[model samples]
Target: MKTTFQHVNYYWDKKKEKDLKNDQIELFLYRSNILGKDLRITNYGGGNTSCKTIEKDPLTNEEVEVMWVKGSGGDIGTLTRQGIAGLYTKRLRDLKKVYKGLHDEDRMVSLFNHCIYDLNSKAPSIDTPLHGLLPFKHIDHLHPDALIAIAAAKDGEKIVKEIWGDTMGWVPWQRPGFDLALQLEKCLNDNPGIRGIVLGSHGLFTWGDTSYECYINSLEVIETASEYIHQKIKKNNTVFGGEKIQSLSKKERLEKAALLAPVLRGLCSSENQMIGHFTDNDAVMEFINSNDLLRLAPMGTSCPDHFLRTKIQPLVLDLETNEDISNTGDIVKKLTPSFEKYRQEYKEYYEQCKHKNSPAMRDPNPVIIIYPGIGMFSFAKNKQTARVASEFYINAINVMKGAEAISEYTSLPRQEAFDIEYWLLEEAKLQRMPKEKPLSRKIALVTGAGGGIGKAIADKLVKEGANVIFADIVENRLREATKSYNKDIGSYILCDVTKEEDIKNALNKTCLDYGGIDIVIHSAGLAISNPIEQTSREDWDTLQNVLVKGQFELIKQAVSVMRKQQLGGNIVSIASKNGLVSGPNNVGYGTAKAAQQHMVRLLAAELAKDKIRVNTVNPDGVIIGSKIWEGDWAEGRAKTYGIDVKDLPAHYAKRNLLNEIIYPEDIANGVFALVAILHKSTGNSINVDGGMASAFVR
Candidate 1:
């Protein structure tokens, strides 16, 4: 009989499996990748899969059994050969004789290194023994939301019996380690012919003689559990005690989210600056708008992985339906007390649960925050971490949904949650992480980032680890410019700097996309060179609008977000040497450049109290790799200098004192020095014109 599934997908393909039939490890990777493709099956970096293979022993010249399992901190969806750890099954089983008791389980983790079958293998995860000790050749351990929902239900054991009778076994809550592995062994041995076991308040485990059987067994168990929960949900009249408030329109929710994100990001980043992520998908909106939110939110999450990323509980913003969310001051006034209360409570939780050997208290700020009628906001050290945290919380919501649909939902005990959160093993893994880049937590917005100098500045910032938003007036240019970058690090938006609405929209998008802005680069401009007799009113206005007024509007809108974040910021304008030098046929462009230069000085002095630094980088004759020079500006300048357009680069280069040519990259370096290196100095112009004496600031 064929079993169809409504909740989980069966992605196995015989043709694909045949290609890797000869290689055991390759088949293991294929199975793991397919299972991890769906978040409902396993969230990012949450689950583990293992296979025992016979490999030649390099030292003995004989075959030995080696258990290959997902290494510590590796995500199964993106797992590679390097991401798997190999250990001798014999050595792992030998440790069972040395095990003193459950209290001494941590010592076994350190001993796992001694069993390494491959010297180059990654460090083994804590769950290594869980797979090694099991008799099956292939095993799968996953924290699927549907299965965890069954595991976390109050009557989880009874429900397990109803679903599979004696065909599956049940084990009570035990933190993953040597003890849990032992319990699983006992359960499987005690219940013969059982295909899997449901770990109470944790997850599910399944095993088989082959990789395909193991994969199919895991799917069957999860699919059955998901169908059971789906039927119960259909029978219920409402979920989460019915929604307490209607959801806001998509436009309203995003507008409110944009305004609230920076303030929340600033408050959460008091100890260390954070990048932000916002999600208003159906899952988040349903949970936040539910009547059960106040009751269930503080109960916290059950799965250790969920609790690790999303903390013990989220901070719930008790926003009333009548409250004015658009008023920034009102939002701040109401949220301040709630933030303070959350911090104080978090500190108390640490005091109550901490052991003498526990690590020092971490930042007390909440990682996840829920705003009713709006959406959820998550913050972390970088954009990806923040986004993943949001995804994990949504998984937690799903687990709760399934549990509450059948029986009362249950969370992990407070002390157990604390033990997992501050475990020494987790701390050691964190210490091994590489140091962050100089601009790791910073966010940047680069106008005119479609190409040339602007694109170069955006690339430099992203290289230094900042999440950048590329803003330009042209759509195709924006798409083409951002194509080469990692989608996570760089994003693009069409923006005309001359319009105030465009500037405002771009800044709002920046806050929504990456939390808030820390660095702003105004490089968008158009040049119009003309003699006094030929200069038109239209030509003068266009230059001023793009070069001067555009810079003014971008800075004006961006500063509000910076101030709200209270993290301080940097503003760099790519002005020109013509701003300082008196050049021919440059009446309109020169005046606009000069205005841009002085505006930096004025803003630097005005925004000093807010710790916002404003500066300028001036470059001249950047003829190669510049869009500005590709147009009329080059021809007009060449005409005035009595040279052909092709000779403009050489003519301009020879005139400089060093006879060096300036490129867009040189201008980018000047901006980098101002923002990344010269932190203490501002209101100064750095000339990158190859030692042009006339452009030097006196």
Candidate 2:
């Protein structure tokens, strides 16, 4: 049975009205922000909204403010004041004459720079001109999930005509920007009375004199379609299925909820309310128990707007377990064939539709799909996009169910569906710009990194632009480190660094996997405080194994691979300030560290021949929310220093010249600076202890 989704909520903050002034600013910012959140209405950063304002200068010059549309690359939910790039409305209208002959990229860039805004705002959205043509001040454009659903179905054009009637004008989906705007202008001139426009398989554009009116009309259009589909679609209640299930415990559910909520927040960057839903109904369970779950998973959205709402699709869960079992990597792996198939068919569809140039192919993965008994799921970047996809899915279920009530609902031809996904005009509308983060493509390895200084170096390397391998003797801890620093750039391996075989194997594996290693930070070592007289031979063996033997083994293996790359490398060791001063009851730890400090210097000289730099970061108590500081380890350390554990922070601070407790992050930064960014220095050691004014050296 085809299930339905609902538009169960709406929200507005009318009380914050006092903060706004100009109609143009208010309309533009609000609509842009809304569009940013809706996926079916927009993809990752697709879609645009705008408003025109009139401004007068002091020289008795009155001019139209033009349209302030969302800039390219900024998501609608994260749309700040700077996100909307403004352009001259009159100047834009003028471009309609000359823009035809110019290259498309130049046309947009020319318009972008001519506009005025604060120095920091996102560049103007390419669709600035389409909004410029509308008579109303506030214009809203979205690829509504419902619209996408209808468009993706069999006889989609016929369905659209039946549902929309004369309420809106329709444009065959076209490439966006100047070309799309030109197409829309032609449509407006031809159908002067039309109140709104729907770009088939693309989205809808509606406008109003006021912001709320425009917003309401946009909602109304979708709601009307939603209600129509809900009332009409029907499905049989009986099916071969499993029994109903018990509800999840509060604690269990909230944890899953938390994992997903953060992802949503990361996607949307909004403060709006969020809600989760699950079903344990018999019919739903029956559907889940069906053998067709995997086969049925790739059917895409009700509309293009689902891109903004649900992302491409939701993480479908098992009905019985209600657990997410879909492997993202597996999905990515399978998509190639589907994409190739989509591309081949798209070529034929384009040939049938027009007499023009061809568009590029898009990957095929069901952007929206029903997971058997799990009802339906939508993926979007934010709440708005999810809402849009949900609405569309509801409508799709209704229409399909309605058709099935009389006869089985037929799907659209694959070629026809492929046309929309690979539509050159729509594809052009997606954001394609790139960014340079602090870290990009460098490779680094961190030892003793289950947590603490070692873990910090691993994290920093990943953040700065390096692929990082977190190595530690604790096997479970190494796995935990990978989980903690989950990213495209992070991986982990368990290596007892003191052992030659383990060190060689780990280094060889890293080189084979990532091509080569460029930076190594040895943060693995033992820290047992003891008097020189009391320290046992066994205790000394343990200290030397990790601190001395481990460091040498790692360096030897790292240099072997690094020397081959010849790209130049950096190695950083976590030494201590105690190695520089006489501290009581610290013979074993301090002596080993002092040896490591000199070993680093010697390695720096020897490795200089191979272009691999070596350095040391002398840390002064790297304290954070790690296992070491959580219990008696912290208490013991503090007691040895004659202070409460809590006061240890202040005690360390007073010892430093800067009066700051040295964080692991600080050490991480120093390590990163010496290796990845600085580029040149080979053997220098940076003291990361906030300036310890100690004199005696080991």
Measured by lDDT, the strongest candidate is 1
Model 1: worst 10 consecutive residues (lDDT sum): 320-329
**Model 1 stretches astray by more than 4 angstroms:** 1-4
lDDT for predicted candidate 1 compared with the true structure: 0.91
Give the per-residue Cα lDDT of candidate 2 at 372: 41
Q: What is candidate 1's lDDT per residue for 520-602, written digit by digit as tens?
A: 99999888888988999999999999999999999998998998888999999999999998988899999999999999999
What lDDT tens digits, residue by residue, belong to model 2 across residues 347-421? Answer: 454456542554543332222433343344333322234434555444443333333333233443344444444
- Assess the local accuracy of residue 526 in candidate 1 as a C-alpha lDDT between 0 and 100: 80
For model 1 the local lDDT of residue 563 reads 82
Best by TM-score: 1
Estimate candidate 2's alpha-carbon lDDT, on a 0 to 1 scale: 0.60
Task: Provide TM-scores for the models.
Answer: 0.97, 0.55
Clashing pairs in 1: none
